[model samples]
Target: MLGSIPDLLRLLAVPVFGWAAYRDIETRRVPNRTWAPLAVLGVVLLLWDTYAVVTGPTSGRLFFVQVAISLGFVAPLAYGFWLIGGFGGADAKAFMLVAVLFPAYPTYYLQTTALPLEPSLVGVFSLTILSNTVLAGVVYPLGVAAGNLVRGRFSWAMFLGKPVAVERLPEEYGRLLEDADGFTRSGLDLDALRMYLQWRGASLSELRAAPDAHRNPDSLPADPNPPGDGSVVTDGGVPASGSPDQFGTAGTADPWGAERFLDDVEGSAYGTDPETLRAGLELLADADEVWVSPGIPFLVPMFVGLVAALVYGDVLYALLSALGLA
Candidate 1:
């Protein structure tokens, strides 16, 4: 009965994490509603499972101790990652949920043959999941580096990211890879740009008003929305269905229909107001290209790590064994 409950929870968690990852990829935000219920259900299932198998004083004590260690250790570690910006809020919460739901590997899902590692290490499912996640995450950068080399885009930052036209920047999930630089600028500090824009009195609205001069003409996305017919594509590429606005028409406040393209550029952490947009425009005025890092949502890798942990057991143990160090 104890075995069946965790196994069932594992089945439930996969789809939930899968959906969360999908949502994160599209919108870069996962609703708290999605996680809250999963968290509650995980706790209830874990408690019931623990109760079902607490046969006597010794076994009950062992179960309680494991629970304490899982909560005490994993919660702090996840919270630390969040505080340090190593993981996002959603990612941290997901880790805590996994620690509660499957503090150890679900043995019933595995083969009859014993796991290669010592039983103690196999039991800490959250640790194994974290290890697997980190290992999987490493592949992305390596792949990016290899692709950059193949395309002759080699540079100091090529491994980290490539340049995209400012207008082509994805509003949903991209970060300015650069701090700040411009010929008219004395400092590369983001705050300095903010102050400069304040001094100049350049507003995002004014920049939006004159899109042709500031925005890259060559980088403009081809208007998929027909004039006065189809849904208007906003700056974030979200369709303004049935709205009056249309792309690539003349005499509109934004002629290029490029308002949505600069949404993130305007509201970046560098600054969220008009000054940030002015700063971005200044940087663009001095350079043809700007580097932007692909904003990877952490939930994507966590879900992958969970599946990997289940199928492969402990990633570190497997690696050590292969290296003849275990």
Candidate 2:
């Protein structure tokens, strides 16, 4: 019964990791609500397993010792990664939960075949998953490098990135990998400011309609009077009635029309927190096209790691043995 319970629980992990990977890919954010149920389930099963082991056999004490070692080692290691920005909150929580769920290899699933190495090397399921995850992560960069080489743009530092038109940048799919060449303003977080603008319904067309509007009506110079309705104005003293095409068209040297539209929005909305707005505008002005890296949604790799641990045991152990190094 104890053996079957962990096997079933290990199967349960597939759906949980799948959902997390899907949500991470789509939104780049994982809600705590997703992890909570899995954590609870893992904890309950862990306690039940602990009870069964303690009551069962001479090897029961060894089971408890393995649990201690797995939890003691993995929990702090996950926390350290979180502290160093190597792992996101959700990723760290998932790793620790994995230690709780599968304190030892799910041996019931390994009925006929033995691991390539002595079981001691990957006694803990969490350690096996971590090793698989690291191997998978390394493969990703090599794939990126190969693609860059094929494209004839083989720079060592930039092999993982591709140039993208600013207008084509998805709201959250990729991160701007390079700083704007000539842009120097610093204060607010540009990413947050972009999110704020979208939330406020301050669209590009609306900002283009009145480029000189400021959040504060008093900041306008004498040349550009605030519209009677108190709409924000641009910094260049341009009123709302000006032409939208003043910012330039797409695919040209001055192909930052969208950015300039955003700049007007920032200038109009610029208030006590103008520094962030200024920094964002400067970043936009840095280049016509910017290098962006489609960031690896970590949950995808976590999911892969879980699946690999179940089917292959420790991948590194298998590889080393196959190469005659083990």
Candidate 3:
């Protein structure tokens, strides 16, 4: 267990570092106060690592090789991430600290450090594709499964992290950003902005006629409960001339499209805060469910491909006796 301390530290740092970056994106300000402490922590950890190297049970030569090689591996990674805006300054610094903390960050470089340029290049290409495919294949399918199993998965989120919801329709056309009530005098509190669908209708039936009713799929909800007789249609009055039948399209043709037409009926009639709140509440309560994927579900294999250059070196090592990179 003690031997895994560095790995544990590295793993722990990811969420801390990533969440801080996320907060900055949300607030448009990355507070120096939060990062100052992490910077100090990084320094302390690096110093501790150096001290451990000097005093630990490992032989001096073995320790030196590990430290130097690890540093070599991480330097390039840090430089690359720096070149891309994907990592903010704080994120990069924290990443370096994480690399130092684990000691394995650089050691992973051993996979390709000594290979001939040609084979190493091939491995790099292979690994890059592998890693990307792995991440996408893993993250996307997982998100879908999780989305289906858990109805409210992030449903209550108003601003919803980074996915800006569009509420434009026949009445409020092209005014999505203007109509958004996400920002308040107190500033953004993500909970305030649960996703909402609005339609222009004096009565629920007219809402089904909106032209966009069939195209935007994710915006629609699944089958909704039938509305009560004396329903309060959505605010701003429903359109006088629109109804799903006016468009002459079969209601059941597309599940996604059908949901749009249904939302109009639901929202137009049951359009009050209580109705919206009730539906939103029901969805939000389902958040605890875990979405199960429809596959072997292991994502690590994809990551193995991200740095495919390792395979090139591995092949060379196996065939040419070249002690190349990992």
Candidate 4:
């Protein structure tokens, strides 16, 4: 089971790529010095797969075929993203790298064939996808939660050294917030809200240029309701949605929305999506939050289904029929 049939390289991609991201995030620079070695390593692996799985023997051909199959599956989705401006070049490249490596992992049953794909090869791929999706979901909210702590409870748990929203006040507004009690019984004036929105808009713009812009000092504001706590509560005053956040976070807000609270941020108003709103609110309740890119959550089903389909072509076909996609 170990003879050159895929083991080391397949598993190495995640850690290698993850470490690179972590380092880049820390340094704000993914130097060519670091990427050079990774590029060489990737090339070597491609050649290894080509020789061992493409030209060595029957199973080898199957391996190469699996790689092709999985890549084929993502073509449509990739195209869709390309058209929608959802992914930058790097995003597409990262996904392609994953595809070239993982290919078809789970071995499917073909000879026996009692019931179509009675055993799906959806184990490893599915688990990985599920875990990734959950992680992304949690991390975004945690960022917003950290923001909430600052905006409501005065905590600095989410500071990443990135730019914080700079209020574009009329030369004197910053002095006002310095008084410790900026928005008390006086009721937050429209000017302040306008300033907040403008700054928020600028922040969103900066974020699009560099997704990691708000890495440091993330904070959400408290709700602007009469009580003015950074909490989203129902009529009874119970916490409305899960609170405490660092920050899903994608939708444009370049245009600012109708009321800019619970609306679309489409090139404006933080691209309106309730889930995005929930995350943004958790970050800064009173201010606007918008997404820079438009990447949807990475669905595990995409990977797992592709692997199973390639390994056991018939099984994949049956799956499609069951879902009526065929």
Query: How many backbone overlaps does candidate 1 show?
Result: 2
The local distance difference test score of model 3 is: 0.36
Question: Per-residue lDDT tens digits of candidate 3, residues 42-113?
Answer: 556567667776888876565455455445555456557766744445445544543444332222223435
State TM-scores per candidate.
Answer: 0.68, 0.69, 0.32, 0.37
Off by over 4 Å in 1: 1-3, 56-62, 109-122, 170-172, 179-281
The order by descending lDDT is: 2, 1, 4, 3
Clashes of 4: 42
lDDT on C-alpha atoms for all candidate structures: 0.58, 0.60, 0.36, 0.37
Query: Candidate 1, residues 137-194: lDDT per residue as tens digits?
Result: 8877787789788988866666666666644442324455663552221112233232
Sort by TM-score, top down from the best: 2, 1, 4, 3
Q: Mind sharing the TM-score for model 3?
A: 0.32
Which residue ranges in model 4 land beyond 4 Å of their true spot? 1-6, 10-15, 23-40, 54-62, 75-83, 106-135, 142-326
Give the worst 10-residue stretch by lDDT in candidate 3: 170-179
TM-score of predicted structure 4 = 0.37
Candidate No. with top lDDT: 2
